[model samples]
Target: MPANESTNSPLDTLWRVHAILWMVVAGEGLAVVLALATETSSDRLTYFGRLSVAIQWVMLLTLVAIYALRKPLSRIRPQGVAYVALCLLLINTWVTAGIAWLLMRDVGPMPAGGWQALVLRLTGIVLAVGLLGLAAFQNHWRARQAAVQAKQAQLESLHSRIRPHFLFNTLNTGVALVRRRPEEVERLLLDLADLFRAALAGPRQISLEDELALARRYLEIEALRFGDRLSVRWELPGVMPAVTVPALSIQPLVENAIRHGVEQLPAGGEVEIAVSTTPGTVVVRITNPLPHPGSHSHPGHRVGLNASQVRIEALTDGRGSVQTQVAGGRYIATVRLPVGT
Candidate 1:
């Protein structure tokens, strides 16, 4: 599975703003229901005020406990996590109800069944709500997991299609070199083997530095075919941050630069690869000159660029992007990845 496919526990979901809002709404609804069920017309307002405090206290304390233990709970099975959350809810309900009972005893007379009965009634309500919430969370989680799996399967399929195209391109480079540059053919084949190995390794992430190295090897092989017509300018940061990107992500874009851009121009052009970083993002840009109008440039299908875009977006959980544009007679492809992902 891709690293980004890992699902968060239900406890994590509870910490989200929308989830918290829903909890507050549900708690208010429960308070209203309890007020109507147990209190007389005259005492309903007073009973609601006290019940609201108790319910909110129970909900808040239970949420806090879950938040504090979220990391540990994430390691356990989903069913076990649900069970633990319900246990915490029950415990908090009893503790909050006991405190409310003692504090309100001197304030007024007890209801028909007294504090003990109130506690029991509160426990039943807590259990029912807790079970219902858990069931809803489990269903939501399963749906999310299924969607992630489907996206991953689609990403893997795209990756598999990309590999053959890369392999065939590199082999063609090697075949060209074998006729006139027999000595260089051995080195070309070795580089081709390394590049293919990485491509064939299946869906996984590679360090930014490692991915750049692979792109360099690919360019080296292409250089053997294009000769002096192909020149590369690399602008790298002084220190490369520790970042991981989908494997083969950068290489394909570089290949596109050579095939569709430099290879079409008569006096070939420079391929500029620039890597820069912001506080929370790493950006890579590849720029190559566009062929002149009426030049023998074949229409590009953009298969590699599209595949790279999908893989990057999927791997980064939509936090990263691959974009391309044409400006100043140059075809520019840019990739942005979120830092510390």
Candidate 2:
């Protein structure tokens, strides 16, 4: 998904160039027999062979160009890629075979039923295979690159939604303490800083223990503002998976619960977060009261929570997911993470 990756890797391109053009040379040798069999003028057939040899070089340049033009190549449709590959295959074979026959003229006729004729036959076959292989693989790699790019784009869009959602909720909470006691501003500022730090950490991968520590830090900050109104129930047991997950994965769910589910209610409510490993999977669940009967939401009430869920699925390639349900005036969100990931 990175810019440099999409573009041709210079090292790889160099290797392919060195490696693949030999297929053309090998194909040209096969053209020798075709040249001997054809009735066309020797000069004309030789010219055609030379042209085919020239075309192989053009193909090498084209492949290099394809690598250099990384973005557009991935955007190419599957069928279009197939068409291109087929065209290249045919063209290289036609051109190289003709050139081989022409070049072989000076070398003398193939000895009938002898080792010389056998060598020419084998060389032709090898060239055909090599050219076909290159075309097939080129299309496959392009398709793979396109898929990866699309997935990365989806992940970025999901992560982009997080900053605004968290900021809105945190600032709203800060405004409450401001009216009653402005002196709490400094302490609140520190909490806000910690919250943002957890939010903006690098990379989508981190250890599970680190994610939990971050979630706890975030909850501690929120607890200062909410006082006893917000309570935490951590149900993590012995031996947690050390696998990586999106950074600060659990905090947003708890934060969302505190902001929209519990903070609005007069009695407040408890936020229960539990994590445990089962076989090859690790599960984390957070539960909070609905604040009132018949509680429901659309988007804005839980954007931060949704962002985290989207990110987890993206990072895990659907190996992880979040399940949510409202039961008995309580909203519950469960996250399933693959331990093997």
Q: How does residue 131 of candidate 1 score in lDDT?
A: 88
* Candidate 2 positional error at 79, Å: 19
lDDT of 2 by residue, 178-229 (tens): 8766887787788778767766763467677877776776676577677878
Q: Against the hidden true structure, what lDDT does model 2 obtain?
A: 0.66
RMSD of each: 3.1, 11.4
What tens digits encode model 1's per-residue C-alpha lDDT throughout 1-341?
27364344455557668879998988889989988887464577877987788888988998999889988888898878888989998999889877876787888777668878877877888888888988987897799878777877877777888889888899888889998799887788788888988988888898999999999999999999999999999999999878888899899999999989999987888999999999899999999999899988886777788888988887776789999999998999999999975
TM-score for candidate 1, please give it. Answer: 0.85
For model 1, the stretches where C-alpha displacement exceeds 4 angstroms are 1-5, 8-56, 102-113, 294-296
> Lowest summed lDDT over 10 consecutive residues: which window, candidate 1?
1-10
TM-score of 2: 0.57
Clash pairs, candidate 1, are: none
* TM-score for each model: 0.85, 0.57
Task: Please give the CA lDDT of all the candidate structures.
Answer: 0.85, 0.66
